[model samples]
Target: MQKEIMSNTLKILCADMVQKANSGHPGAPMGLSDIAVVLSHHLHLNPQDSSWLNRDRLVFSGGHCSALVYSLLHLWGFDVSLEDLKQFRQLGSKTPGHPEFGHTHGVEITTGPLGQGVANAVGFAMASKYAQRILGENVISHFVYCLCGDGDLEEGISYEACSLAGHHQLSNLILIYDSNKITIEGGTEIALSENIARRFEAQGFDVFECDGHNFDSIDLAIKSAKESCKPALIIAHTVIGKNAVGVEGSHKTHGAPLGAEVVAASKEFMGFEKDQAFVIAQEVKSAFEASIAKGMSECEKWKKSLSQEVQSKIAELQNPDFSQVQYPAFKQGDKVATRVSNGEILNAIARSYSGLVGGSADLGPSNNTLLKNEGDFPKGRNLHFGVREHAMGAICNGIANYGLFLPYCATFFVFSDYMAPSVRVASIMKTQVMYVWTHDSIGVGEDGATHQPIEQLSHFRAMPNLLVFRPADANENIACMQVALEMKAPSAFVLSRQNLEVLSPVSKDQVQKGAYVILESENPDVILLATGSEVNLALKGAEMLKNQGKSVRVVSMPCMELFSQQDQAYQDSILSNRNKTIAIEASRGMEWYRYAKVVIGMDSFGASGKGDDLFVFFKISVEEIVKKAQEI
Candidate 1:
């Protein structure tokens, strides 16, 4: 009786929201009414202790069905008020067009982009398994259930992440696919007709099919998933609009709300007293209250365990001093590409840090993101992010937001454009997600313009609160990683694909300080500011000028974000206000306007050629840099 009442109440809420806003996708909300009832009423969740470390995580990868997710939250014991539902699609309401994390009580991750949520669920599931391995099975083991749509299946990233999940045998991960046979454009049959169940079976998931409206089938499938020792995917067959009389079983109902007349008729069919908004019976309220109480009891036991376990683990790991520690020491004059240096530094940090996880977007080998002898995060330390760069960025953000792990994702620097959105979100959220981007410029030679990053650095630097760092040598790379690891904001460690001689003058302390005394000032008439590969060119240019009886200073400004954070006096000291300054880099000049009198940079696109030829073509070589500095 309680289940019936809650399911009907959910239907009413879905109808009310869609009708009031005259917007939103109501089909899935109506179709999955029973699934929502079973998950919300029976699934383990503690609203009062939402941050409880061991609670199960839920994500709606098919976020267009947000009305269903929010209605479930409201029906369960979440803080989403009925009034909030009434204000759906309005400004400042918790119930928005789609679920947004941190804006709502129970939303674990912000999921609007389809396949990303599935990929993030893979990360969450992987983290859960690793947490149990590190912290003990009894300490932290919880399920990660994600509801996906046919759209999610088609997004390409799903295959990449899901393939890895199956390979790892992440039995704790459960996917509920809403196979309603519809998309925004038209019936999914128009473009998609492959057997999704067979595909999941091939990918090594325990696949199940059930009637969407049957609570018993949904409950049994979920229970089976929890018991299975492999990842599971329930392809629940459902109608597009189950109760909408006009468009039931059709794509027309996929995204639009039924009109006022049809909504009233649907309310009557559901046996509602009237077309009331946010209607739920007192009996349903009592049921949820009882569920909340039960969760509270579970919370008490978990709380005691977590307190003791976290402390003991912290002691076991000998938690490093997180309060502004010194950078790793680096001797001067070591020639090393920043990419190789980055790998060395990350492995060094991992030796002391237990929670750090690093991976590349299927480019770990090329990007040099693998930790030394670090087994594939295989249910443990490293992650293979597949080739889904966009989802990889967002998954890194999700893992960081979990707060239990320090997450890092890598890809070629040119692909930073694909990851810009998630990276920006990480910066905005102030999450410590590190991005290891190599092949930072035209140095990616022969791969042509498409593989080279010409304007990405400027794009990242233009974003507020994001650190864009390109270290010159192995020492600077190590220092840059250290600073990025310490920052609570998103940081990009840009590296070259080509080998670079490790410069001998940059110290670890100087790199940590951002702009360091790479070359001492000789009361120079001019100063050379450089980053990444151009720093070596700048040094050479300075040496040539010095030979010509010119006083010059060269500063390696690897991290603009860190440097800008230093006091004005420090900045003025490194980039002398009186001295004529020339800033050089192998990328766009957009962010160099304030620090240089003349910026010798790549303002135009790059093309395929030998690395040396490319450098000459762009005129970013040492000779060109020296000529530009002399003119300035």
Candidate 2:
């Protein structure tokens, strides 16, 4: 009876929050209330220690059900209050329309875009496995639970992430699918028809079914799921708006509030006074208090029983010291592709820091991202993410959020489009994920226009909070990697497939500022700015112009994002008044206008040929750069 009242209280609060806002979804929370009640009772959470390392993670994959999560957090006493519930969906409120990870105390990850949370949960599960392997099960053992809806399963990314989870045998991960058979538009039967259990079984998941509203059935299914040798999926059959007075089980109840009269009648029917709102019975409060006290006791026991070695490991994982990291040095004039340099630096970092873990999207060799000799992940440091770029990105974010690892994902620069959404989420959440993107330009050669990336650099540079680096040579690549490691936000290293000459007298400190004059000419007539492969062309063009008695300065602007963040004084120092300033790169040059008077770059797709031939054809060569400089 107490459990039933607690479930009803959750539903009433969710309905009231949404109705007061006159916006937001109320159906899933109402339908999933009973499951939430059961899960809340069983979840290993300590409200007093919300950041406890071994605590189980819960992701609301169907994030429109934010009301339910907020209500549960409030009831469980995690800083969310009755006033916070009243302020749902309002501007600057802790209770935003969608659950934002860092913005809320217990929200795991910023989830709103359909299937991202599911993918993130997979990542969280993967991180847990990795942590357990390193720290031992006694120190780190927990489950990753996600509440997803039909729309989450319908999205393609969920399939990608879930497939990887099954392949890895992440038995610690459990997905509770609220099979309410409804979407905002109408019944899910209109679009979805696949047997979900069969699909999951095919993906190597232990599948189970239960009545969502029945606490005993939900508990039994979860118990069986925990004992599985493979990842598990519990399909909890439910009715949309399960207990609403008039609109129960109807599609109209999916996104809108039950009218005030319906809400009052529903409360009355649930044995609550119709006149009151946000009311929690005393028994529900006692039940939560008992659970919280038990969790606190468990947390205290875990802390007391931890060995000194395990405690040290935990401390190191949480706070990594990168200041003493010694980076490998590069010789000037060495003909090395930035991708190869990136691989060398990655291995060096992995050797020094156990927290560095990630893999390419099945492009390790080409992207040069493998941590050589570091076995496979969960046992080895390297992760082979197969060809799933989208899942790989979210998985990296998950690992980063796990608070022990610095995660990175790699792919060809052109394929960044496949992972852009996840990358955006990382930026939004300020997760310190690194993206190693190789084959950064038309220099991809005979692979042709389809394989080369012309606008990707500009697209990423435009995104806020993302540090985009296009290192000119080996040394700059190392410097970019160093900066990425130290940065609090996400970073991407756009590396080259073709070898570049290691520029003489490289300044790692200057590169940290984003752009630096590689070769400064006294009394400069023209300032030539470039990045990646074009930096060498800019240098050669500067020499040619200098031979013609025109003093020219060459600047390697490897990271536009970092450069833009510099103070106006520093920017002016590098981009001071000159007779003419020209920017050269192999992609669309519009972004260069902020620092240069003329932009020399590709305005069309590349042709299939030798990389050098394509560079000449695209007029991104030394000769063309000189000609343009002469014209200027």
Candidate 3:
């Protein structure tokens, strides 16, 4: 009886909110209310302490149904208020069109794009497993629950992440699928045909089904899923726009509001006052309060019994000892690839800091991202993400948000496109999910244009708050990493495939400044700017120019995003007189125009030849830089 009232109250509140906003998705909220009732009984969350480490992680993969999210949060004793519900979809409101993690008190991970949330949940499950191994079962034990819809299951990332979850045998992960069979265009039959249950079973998930509108059946399904030894999926067959008077089972209510009259009728049908908006009866609030009380009790018990070992583990991860870190030193003039140095530096950091864990997307051998002797995930530091680049990014974002560990993922530089969406979200959330992208240019020999990343450097550098680092040599790579370690935001470490001669030991200040004079000449005829491998090229070109009696100042701009943030005075000091400055990189280099006038860069696609030959053929060589500098 209490479940019925609560579900109906949520339904009415959701319908009225969309009606008021005249924008936002109403159907999903209406469809999933019944499941929410069962979920409330089982999910462990403390509104008073939303960041409770041992609390069950709930991810709304179908984040469009934010009306339902706020309604549940308000009833379950979260800070979300009745006024927030009334302000749904409004600018500057707590109830935005989609749930944002830090923006909303109870949101675990910012989820909007369909399938990424499922991957995020898997990541949480993985994090829980790792935390459990470190802090012990007494300290970290939590199930990760994700509420997803048909649209989410249809996305390719779902398959990639789910497959990895199955491979890892993450029994604490449960996915609740709202099988509403509706899309923006109409019924899902228009695009989907495969049996979802069979697919999940094939991916090693224990599957269950329930009547979405039946409270007992939904409860039973969730209970059974929790008991499963494998990652579980509970398919709830639901009616889209469940209680809307006219569109109850239709897709018309998917992305838009139900009309005022229809909402009123739906409310009345659900035993609510026809005109009442954001309705939550005292009895329903009390019932949700009971659930909150139970959760708080569990939270208190967990907090009171904090073991000394648990405290130490948590403290270690929360505040990693950066000073204890022994950074590998590269000898000046030693030919070492940035990727190789990055691997050594990564291992060096992991050896001291147990809080850092990550892996490459099947490029461990080539990318040099393998954490040696750090076994497999959930037990060791190395996480084998296989070839799932998109899921790898999203999962790393999840791990970063899990609060105990810093996460990183690696892949060939060009394939950053596969996971670009997740990277954007990481930037938005300011998740410290480092991207170690190697084979940074036309230097990916024989693999051809498909493997080379030309525009990727500029493309990511343009993204707000995402620091893109292209270290000139091994020592600069260390400097870039030094800056990356202290940042709370996402960063991309772009490493070269070929060896670059170490020029000098770079100071953290130099890398933090994003650009510094690597080689300087008095009253320069031309100021040459470059990044990554091009810095060495620029230096070589500058030496040729010096032999010909032309003065030059060569600058290594490792990170453009950081460089742009510097004061105009500092920027002028590095890029003095734009007309006399030439930016050289193997990639597009279009963004360099902000600091340099003449740019020596690749305008055409690279070919399948030796990396050095391809560089000269593509006119990104010493000769090209000198010619462009001379022309300037």
- Those runs of model 2 whose alpha carbons end farther than 4 Å from true positions after fitting are none
| lDDT (tens digit, per residue) of candidate 2 on 95-143 | 9998997898888898888899999999999999999999898888788
Instruction: Indicate the residue-level lDDT of 34 in model 2.
Output: 93
Give lDDT: candidate 3, residue 48. Answer: 86
Candidate 2 positional error at 357, Å: 0.6
Error of 1 at 295 (Å): 3.2
Q: Provide the TM-score for each candidate, comma-separated.
A: 0.89, 0.97, 0.99
Error of 2 at 581 (Å): 1.8
**Candidate order, TM-score descending:** 3, 2, 1
Residue 350 displacement (Å), model 1: 0.9
The C-alpha stretches of model 1 lying farther than 4 A from their native spots are: 273-275, 305-311, 314-320, 323-328, 386-391, 417-429, 462-465, 501-527, 546-555, 561-581, 593-597, 603-610
Q: For model 1, how does the per-residue alpha-carbon lDDT over 380-416 read when each residue is reduced to its tens digit?
A: 5788877778778877876776657888889999998
Better of 2 and 3 by lDDT: 3
**Backbone clash count for every predicted candidate, in the order shown:** 8, 0, 0
Clashes by residue pair, model 3: none
Q: Residue 26, candidate 1: how far off, in angstroms?
A: 2.6
- Provide the RMSD of all predictions against the true structure, rounded to 1 decimal: 3.4, 1.5, 1.0
The window of 10 residues in a row where model 2 has the poorest summed lDDT is 288-297
